[model samples]
Target: MNLVLIAMIAAMLIPMYEAWKDDNIWQKMLALASISSKAGIMTLFISVLRDDWMIGVVGAIILTVGNAGLMLLAHVIKRLDDL
Candidate 1:
């Protein structure tokens, strides 16, 4: 279980590296989305391990709703770029 959390944390870093190294707006948005999802997943994992329902609910919310806002922002950015 600890190893799984560690692996997830490591996975999250890949996007950060990409966002840091690349200058593309799309890539940065994608990376931000990835990070958000990973964080939700990590929260879910921790909630499961701790047997906490409140935290689990929060995690579920993040998993379901977090990306929508990011995607909306991405779309706005894309539209602005196209203008």
Candidate 2:
């Protein structure tokens, strides 16, 4: 794997792991990671590339919300089936 890629992944995940290890840091790490995951990729290409980081940030937000909604929907469906 590329070193730069590894570095980026580390930057994004290291804080998250530290947060996971302790309750107080968990929320901050997760929130930062979630935002970073959405925005970080765009940052790599936005300057030399065509698209802006704003789109990437928006996509990330949608991804997180969509994933949570999917989980909730699945849980509700399972509950309905049980009834």
Candidate 3:
């Protein structure tokens, strides 16, 4: 299980690299979204491993809310880009 968590974390870096290697705003936004979700998943996994409901609740909130904010930001950026 720990190994799985490690692997998932390592996988999250791939998006970071892509975001860094390119200069596209949308791609960077996508990578940011991916990172957010992976972090939420990692948090959930840790919560499960520790059997802590508080951690799980925090993770659940991140999972539910994190991406919405990122997407809203992306939309704002897109709209600004059109102007």
Q: lDDT: which candidate is best?
A: 3
lDDT of 2 by residue, 1-83 (tens): 35755676566666666666675433553545564554445354443354566765665565566546545655676678679
Which pairs of residues collide in candidate 2? Answer: none
Off by over 4 Å in 1: none
- Write the residue-wise lDDT of candidate 1 on 1-83 in tens digits: 88998999999999989789989888888998899899998998899899999998998899899899988999999999999
Cα lDDT, all candidates: 0.91, 0.56, 0.93
Predicted candidate 3 versus true structure: per-residue lDDT over 1-83, tens digit per residue: 87898899899999999899999889999999999999999999899999999999999999999999999999999999999
For all candidates, the clash counts are 0, 0, 0
TM-score of each: 0.89, 0.39, 0.92
Clashing pairs in 3: none
Q: Indicate the residue-level lDDT of 10 in model 2.
A: 64
Query: Looking at model 2, which ten-residue stretch has the lowest summed lDDT?
Result: 39-48
